[model samples]
Target: MTFKNTLEFAQKLDAEDKLARYREEFIFPQHNGENVIYFTGNSLGLQPKSAKRYVDEIMTDWANLAVEGHFYAEKPWWDYHDRFAQKLAKVVGAKPAEVTVMNTLTVNLHLLMASFYRPKGKRYKIICEEKAFPSDQYMISSQVRFHGYKPEDAIVEIKKREGEHNLRTEDILNKIEKVGSECALVLIGGVNYYTGQVLAMEEITKAGHKVGAFVGWDLAHAAGNIALKLHDWQVDFAAWCSYKYMNSGPGNASGCFINEKYHNLKDIPRFEGWWGHKKDERFLMKPEFKPEAGANAWQISNPPVLAMAPYLASLELFAEVGMPALIEKRNTIVAYLEFILQEIDKEVPGTFEIITPSRQEERGTQLSVFLHGQGKALFDYLMNHGVITDWREPNVIRLAPAPFYCSFEDMYNFGQILKKGIQDKS
Candidate 1:
């Protein structure tokens, strides 16, 4: 897997790639009248060409069937969300009954916490990574506040050992133990947005359970980017947005996974809606709220068919290729990217320092490079040159080489652009 910083080498890899054809399936943004290197898939995935049809199918059904679309349309608006259950379940490595599409990621996170984050007796603290995605921090903080616990006392933030950019798995597990009887939940982003470090979910889940804490993951970065086995990992609950690596349209419908162990537990309280009512008797609405089986019980409203259509489009691609193939292809291209960047650094000794973990297993598709000598102006310069990337405050440029549309040549070309950017700034 030796990588050369040459267009021919990149083109050769693209030619040999099994997943290369998927690039054509997406419509990339143009800069200078040519396709731009869209490394922002970790933020908003490229639009799938088929998204329109899936969305139009729903619109057509509504036009033709009107009220009857609820029961008689192609996908049947009544159970439109069900169509994605099997397809999405495959992507996240969960049983069909364990996965369900519902509100957006943060909303679902709030819903799941209502059930899983119940603080009682001595167990009142929630353990999560320091610098969690802001929404999660706000959600956890609010949840604790609602329960009459101050965030400072109830939310335990696990910090990186001083001087380290990334968190050590052992430190995280040790933090869970330190809280012991006080910890009620261990909620962490499966892949950190800042460092792109893929936390050891299985081991973390085990550690959380050992201390009798409810465990969950915010999979916004992990879903579709990494291989997840939420079921096998004994993940108590999890949630993710579809817009990122899922390649669904921006701010689309999101999904959640509730372990089968808690599927029918009446003791668990959830923010329920009529859609989550028993399907057979939903029309015969009783004052009593009879819960549906599995993760669907967590759903709060009738799904927005239009919003879910694009996600269905992405899920179709995922179901076709599956994770094993996607992971293999992703690791290869990521390796190529690492080689290119290190070579650039070899030329310009302090161009950037990749804060993302070096090991393939510890990261997903993203490489969070902490710009050393350069700053946002250099990042802006790259953008002006059509090298699209995400810039985080302080000093990090996040580039995710998406498997959906980004080619190996994009990575190589980015290397050249970055090198020149550094030189020009100098």
Candidate 2:
């Protein structure tokens, strides 16, 4: 789909979009009463209008039933967390029992680490990307420290070759092989938050397993933005926050996945809480901690129904428009964005370059632009002009044109703004 100009291209793409109707479902943020071309879905997705209704339903139950809402309401607040599991499982390609909605992203990462990051005498190191999200880095470092290991000795950080923006799979595989005997776990983001580089999960999992190390993923940016097959990939454990791409509200309840193979593993120690106890035997209040068979066994506390509401709303939207179809649409828009961005780069030489992979399958919806010298200024100019996107430190601006609501027009408009912003700054 070539465009004569940005506007015409946007209008044409919007006309052909199968998911175009979904745009009406969200509340687009406005600046000075004008709708902003929201490309920041990679940071915090716009709220679905149905989110209000979902919250209201719970609110109504809370109002009328009060204390009884837990046991007597229509959906029964006591089991409300289970209501979201089926749809969430579909989104991430896991069996219903293998997935559960629970605590926030960082918290869940720690909980999963407790169960999966067991480091025996010789196998005590963990491998992760060099620029993982700050919270993830903190969690891994602290976990290593808690287990009586120095982070320098226990954490192995992988970086790309000099001048390269993305890590190569071969390099990662080699690193895993080199340290396989000493490595206990491999934790990585499905799509890097800063570079938008999608790692080869299947190959990574295979490499880790061959070396007898556990594999887990931090899917905060990948969930809903990309298609995931956790079970098929043999991902031992995974965790994600629902705010980005999922269109769930800010700080929404997070989710986790555990392979069914671990369902019967008795030696894997987990930090136990009452909510994770088997449901039927929960009321018995038995002293022994007999965990529920699958991912629910990892839960520590009762779920926050309010936090889960927005996620349920988002998952219903995902189910309505399946992931494969969404991925196809996303690939088209992302390619178009890349094309235009490259055009801009050509016009203003040496100003900016896309750091995300060029291959369609190697990325999700995001394009991380590396600004050569004036990144912060250019980012500020775009933001002030109402072209909203995210800026990472040192020098990269990330834009994700989410398929659920973003139009080709939004991308074209963003290109126009970006070109103008770059030229003006140059």
Candidate 3:
């Protein structure tokens, strides 16, 4: 699609969009009873209208069946976690057996790390991007320390070149080559939280594996925002929270993916619980922990049906639109946003810079805008005026036009608001 300069062009794009009707499926927030142009899906996605009904189903099951709801409920809460796996797998490009809906993001990360980050004698270091989400940094540091290794010695942080905001794929490959022998695991965010830089997962995974390192990704920002091929990319494991692009409510149930290649590996130690036991003999109360094959083996406890309700509801929507089609639409909308933001920058030179990569393949739905002067104040003003966006520390304001609900008009309106906000301040 060519660059469009006016709101009419955006509206025409929206008018022609096949996924256009999906927007009304969500419940947009109101400021003074008016629906504001919401661009914060990078932080918290809008609630699905069907979510209430989904939660109510669980509530009804609990009211009637109580403990027996596990086996007898309408949806059979006993295997409820498995219900959404196949569809969720489609979104992340993993085999159905390789994906499991389970605990929250950070907890799942710790669990996957336990299995993958086995630091033996000479191979003890872990590699990750430097500006990773703080939770990931803390998890890696704590895990390294727990293994009686100094974080400084055991953690290798790959950073972008000075004066640049995104990591280069070549630099990442070089680092992996240089440290592959000592690296126990290569863990990275599939898409960076701050810069919105989508890493070259296929190349990174191959490089990491060439060094005999386990490759894992934190897909918190990438799962629903971009098309992932975890199995094809040969990523050993991955985990993601559903609250963002997945549009589940805050603190929603999270998911993890384990490649089928590990399904038969009996020696990979896991933190086991009864819920992970094979279904046929799960009720036998057997002393031996015979884990279910694939990612389900990582389950530590029975999932909260209430917590998973929203995710199931959201997945149904994803199933309807299909990820490939949604991604095609997302590429167009994101490009539209970038084009408009660039035009705004041209008019007000030196006032703002887009830190996200301009290339479509290097990003998802987000654009990280770096305000030059009065960053926080400008962000505050935008927010006060009902332009909802998320502000990161230092100077970045992140805006995501989620493909499911965000319209092209939203991007056009945001550009206008941003220009006016900056000009008024100037």
Worst lDDT 10-window in candidate 3:
28-37
Q: Candidate 1 — which pairs collide?
A: none
Instruction: Mark the regions of model 2 whose C-alpha exceeds 4 Å error after superposition.
Output: none
* Candidate 2 per-residue C-alpha lDDT over 132-216 given as tens digits, one digit per residue, 9 for 90 to 100: 8999999999999999999999999998999898999999999999997998999999899998989999999999999999999
Candidate 3, residues 23-90: lDDT per residue as tens digits?
A: 99999877778677888888889999999999999899889889999999989988999888889989
TM-score of 1: 0.99
lDDT of all predictions: 0.92, 0.90, 0.91
Sorting all predicted structures by lDDT, with the top scorer first, yields 1, 3, 2
Question: What's the lDDT for residue 51 in model 1?
Answer: 95
Scored by lDDT, model 1 comes in at 0.92
lDDT of 1 by residue, 1-426 (tens): 778999999999999999999999999889999999898999999999999999899889889989899999878888988888898888888999999998899999999999999899999999999999999999999999999999999999999988899999999999999999899999999999998999999999999999999999999999999999999999999999999999888898889999999987878888989989988898997989988888988887888988998999889999898889899989988889989999999999887899999988899999999998688988999899998899999999998998868899999999999889899998
Residue 317 error, candidate 2, Å: 0.4
Task: Please state the error at residue 244 of candidate 3 in Å.
Answer: 0.7
TM-scores, in order shown?
0.99, 0.97, 0.98
* Collision pairs in model 2: none
Q: After superposition, how far is residue 177 of candidate 3 from its true place, in Å?
A: 0.5
